[model samples]
Target: MRGSVRKILLVFSFVLILLGFWFSTTNAYTFIKGYMLFQTDQTHIVNSAEEPSKQHKDNLKQKKLYTIRPNKGENIGNLLIPKLNATLPIFHGTDEEELENGVGHFDKSVLPGEKDNSVLSGHRDTVFRKLGEVGKGDTLIVETSAGSFTYKIRHVRIVDKDDRTVIVPKPRATLTLSTCYPFDFIGASPERYILVADLISQKLT
Candidate 1:
C-alpha cells in the first residue's frame, strides 16, 4: 500500500511539471506576438494618421526644437516614412553610434520648409528597413504634434563615402534620406544610399 501511494504522488508531480512548462511557453509566445503586433501597428498609425487631433503634437516641434550640433542630443520631433511603414524617435546630431537604432537628425539638415536641404538618418535594419521598398512619388510625412509636413520622392541614389554634395544645405524644401550603403554587403558597408524628395504639401492636423 505504501509503495503504491508513493508512485501515485510521483506521477502527479511529474504531470504538474509538464503542465507548468507548457503554460509558460504558451504565455511567452502569446506575449511576443502581441508586442510585435503593437510595434507594427504603431508604425503604421504614426506614418499614416491624417487625423488632425492625433498629430497635434508635431506642429509644436518646429519652434520648440533646438539646433544642437554633433555630440549634442536634442529631440527633433518624430519622423514618419510611410513607404517604410516606420515611425522612429528623431534626434539631433548625426552621431553614428546614436543612429544605430533611431533616426538621427542631421545637425544642419534642413527643417521641413526652412532652407534648401534637410536630412534625417535612421538605421536601415530596424526602424527604417521599409525605406528599401520606397519608390518615386511615395509620401514621406514628418509630424510635429501640431501638424504634418509631407514630401514626394524625386530620386534615389547610392553614393560613395566621399560624396559630400548630398549633405549640403539646399535652397528648396527637400528631404534627403540617408543610410549605410551596399545594403547587401555582408561586411562593413563602405557607401551611402540617399533618397531625395521635394516638399509637396504641409497641413495642420
Candidate 2:
C-alpha cells in the first residue's frame, strides 16, 4: 500500500510541474502576440495615409509646426533606432499597459524635434532589449504627424531609477531613452539605463 501511494504521489507531482511549464509558456506566447498586434496597427498608421504626393507636399510646406501634446495612451509616433534595428510605436504615458506594448513619451517633456528634452521610456525586456547595444553616433529617428526628427547618440549611462536629472529640460533639442538596467534580470531592477542624443536633423514631412 505504501509503495503504491508513493508512485501515485510522484506521478501527480510530475503532472503539476508539466502543467506549470505549460501555463508559463502560454502566457509568454500570448504577450508576444499582443505586442505584435500593436506593432502592426502602428505601422499601418504611417503606411496607409490617404493623401497624394502633391497634396502632402503642399500641406507640409504650408502647415505651421507646433508641439504635439498627446493624452495618456495616445499613439504619438514611431521611434526607430537604426543601429539596433528597432522600430516601435511611441505612446503618450509610461503606464503599465503603455510600456507593455511599446515605448512611452513623458507627458511633461516637449515633443520630439521641439526645443527641449523629449523623454521616452520602454521596458528592458520588450522594445528596448537592444538599447544597450546602441553606440555613440547611432541615429534615433522619430516619425510623427508633425515631422521627422533624427538624433545622434551622444552619451549613455546607468543611473538609479529615481534619477530625475536625465529627464530635466535642456536648452536645445535633446532625446533621452530610458530602460531598466540589467535587461536579463528576472525581477524588478533598481537601476535605469539612459541614452542621450542630440537632434542632428529634422524634416517637416
Candidate 3:
C-alpha cells in the first residue's frame, strides 16, 4: 500500500509540472504576437503621416519642371504704372532693340512675379520718362502669360550707373525698375534711378 501511494503522488506532481510549462509557453507566444502587431500598426501610421508631405514636394517639383520659360527677346508681358497711368510692353531681353521698343527685362534675372529679383530697364527719355513720379507706396502691376502680379514700391534708390545691387537676389518676389538718373539730363547719366517693389498680390492665369 505504501509503495502504491508514493507512485500516485509522484505522477500527480509530474502532471502539475507539465501543465505549468504549457501555460508559460502559451503566454510567451501570445505576448510576442501582440508586440509584433503593435509594431506593424506603428509603422503603418508613420507611413500614412509622411505620404502627403512627399506628394506635395513632388507636385511642386513637377510645376517647376514644366514651367514655360520665354526665349531671349520674346515679348513676355506688360507693366502697368497706376501712378503714372501708363502701360508699357515688356520684352525678355535688355538689348538696345528691346529698350527702344518698350521695357526690357534683364536676361540674367528671373521673370517678373517669380521669386527673387526681376529687373526691368528702359531709357530715361522714353519708356521711363516719368518714372520719377512713381515713388514709395505706389503700385506697379506686371501682366504676364503666367499671371498678373501687383507690386508696391517700397524704396527708391539712386545708385551709380555701374551698381550691380539692382540685380541682386531678394528673399521674396521683387521688382526692380532701372533708368538713367536725372530724368531731364541732356546726355548719358552718371547714376541710375531704381524702384524696388515687393509683390503684394497675384492673379494666376
Best by TM-score: 3
Ranking by TM-score: 3, 2, 1
Model 2, 1-205: lDDT tens per residue? 9999999999999999999999989999999999999999988875676446657888766345565457899998999988877789999898898898799998888888888899999998889988889878789999988889999999988999899898898998899999999888778898999999999989997
What ranges in model 1 sit over 4 Å off?
1-71
Model 3 misplacement above 4 A: 1-12, 55-66
Any idea what lDDT model 3 has?
A: 0.92
How accurate locally, in lDDT, is each candidate? 0.75, 0.89, 0.92
- Which scores better on TM-score, 1 or 2? 2
Better of 2 and 3 by lDDT: 3
Report the C-alpha displacement of residue 203, candidate 1, in angstroms. Answer: 1.9
User: Which 10 consecutive positions of candidate 3 have the poorest summed lDDT?
Assistant: 59-68
Which pairs of residues collide in candidate 3?
none
* Per-residue accuracy of model 3 over 1-205 as CA lDDT, tens digit each: 9999999999999999999999989999999999999999999999999999999888776133118788878899899999989999999899998999999999999888788899999999999999999999999999998889999999999999999989999998899999999998888899999999999998887
The C-alpha stretches of model 2 lying farther than 4 A from their native spots are: 1-64
Across 73-135, the per-residue lDDT of candidate 1 in tens digits comes to 656567777766767777767787658647887776655545478888776666666677886
